[model samples]
Target: MSSSKKARTHPQYELLYWPGKMPGRGEFIRLVFEAAGVSYRDVSNEEENGMKIILDMISPESTGDSDSNPPVFAPPALRIPGEGKDGKALLIYQTPSILSYLGDRLGLAGEDEAEKAWVLSHALTALDLNNEAHDTHHPIAVAEFYEDQKEESLKKAKNFREVRIPKFLGFFERVLKGNEKQGEGKYLVGSKLSFADTTVWHVLNGLQFAFPKELGSRKKEFPTLFETFYQSVQEQSRLKEYLASDRRFPFSQGIYRYYPELDRQ
Candidate 1:
């Protein structure tokens, strides 16, 4: 990916996650960088043996690295050069934490302390929905194959489409309505776009892919959310280009998966 003029001054941010087409949690961090028009190295996607790099980063046998940075617990970690002790690379994990850290530097956190807090809060809530969506397809166990728990997945997906989806979508709809004075029904926090908006938008986009029929039927019920907020976030100049570009991978067997049997009949 080409770097913008503004991105040239910043450190080369490296994203370490599972390789290939799945957006996964790394997409959250990607959105922040894309929205800010900043450049970052999607290490696992761009470099050879990049998946091995992620495996080594999260290896159980390793306690810490030579750079004195603590071991990451999982994928989607961010490595920033010259940000650690003695100018070593700073390594951080956890999707929410990584997004928050980048949010501030990228100017997507919010304008002030209160907006920042709300931004994080809203982002966390959206991630909760993302996790719930994942559970629908693997309700019995994460390590086990979905086919082994197909029966359970059916029940889980049903409850998710009928209950959990509306719960989360309604909550966000109300948030946008409440913030309409400042956000004009397009943002979840303050006036401008924040990481929270992108975070929530991505989750909603995943929901559409995972449960097309369900989301299609429910869109009218949450006009502000599905119509205004969702449409606005995608139309953002940089995000619009990124969404259409090859960089934005299609939704597949990642956090969001499509199963016709799991979707609405």
Candidate 2:
């Protein structure tokens, strides 16, 4: 036999998302992959015809043509190589489902079934906060521009800043404190870092990016809860490199947009 060695082949993960400078909902999935040290192709704006690929997948033509495959409703979908029926590629969408799938695959879900359930529960709750944060600027309609709903957004944002933010942050704070009281460590679930902690970190980062003044003012209340969690996540070595890398997109017009008029503290 020849002395040459065959190259190892790793599974390819393709992420389909909107082409822009914003991180959007895709950031949640990216965090899991990065923390797990799994390599993935972020094809949103990084590749040629990337947007077209996403458009085609979700379009009526392709979605209707794939009788055996489930239709994807939107972007932020993940395509895994050779994991589908008959050794085809597998496609999964929706942030929560995608994150859960990746979390389980990458061993970030938890150490056991019960712990996984707790992680999923907290992740879904963090998603709720993300949705609410997105709605602050687009209160009336998502398709419409922020200027179109400026009047309504002002009132909605005030309530979000004054009411909803506190409610959700307080809930997380209570959960963290409860976990600590029970000797479950600083993590959201169990004593180890789970996907739930990463989700919470992203949510807190987005909130701070969108409403810096408002969230910063309340830092004293959730010192050990939200603040500490965010700090800890940033300190993760691999995650830190990913965050400082060019591959990590910064928060922009996606999910959490900062409009001066709506960011009243």
C-alpha lDDT values of all predictions: 0.93, 0.82
- Clashing residue pairs found in predicted model 1: none
- Model 2, 1-265: lDDT tens digits are 0012423243677877887747898888888888887777787676788778878889875643242458889878988878877777888899989988888888889889998999999999999999999898899999999999999999999999999989998888887877885424358887777889889899998888889899878888887775566787788887898889877878888898888777755
Lowest summed lDDT across 10 adjacent residues in model 1 is found at 1-10
- Candidate 2 local accuracy as lDDT? 0.82
Model 2 poorest ten-residue lDDT run: 1-10
Measured by C-alpha RMSD in angstroms, how accurate is candidate 1? 1.2
Model 1, range 1-265, lDDT digits (tens) per residue? 4444553778899988899968999999999999988899898788899878889999999999999999899888999999989999999999999999999998999999999999999999999999999999989899999999999999999999999999999999999999999999999998999999999999999999999999999999999998899999999999999999999999989889999999999
Which candidate leads in TM-score?
1
Q: Tell how far residue 104 is off in model 2, in angstroms.
A: 0.7
TM-score of each: 0.97, 0.92
Q: How accurate is candidate 1 locally (lDDT)?
A: 0.93
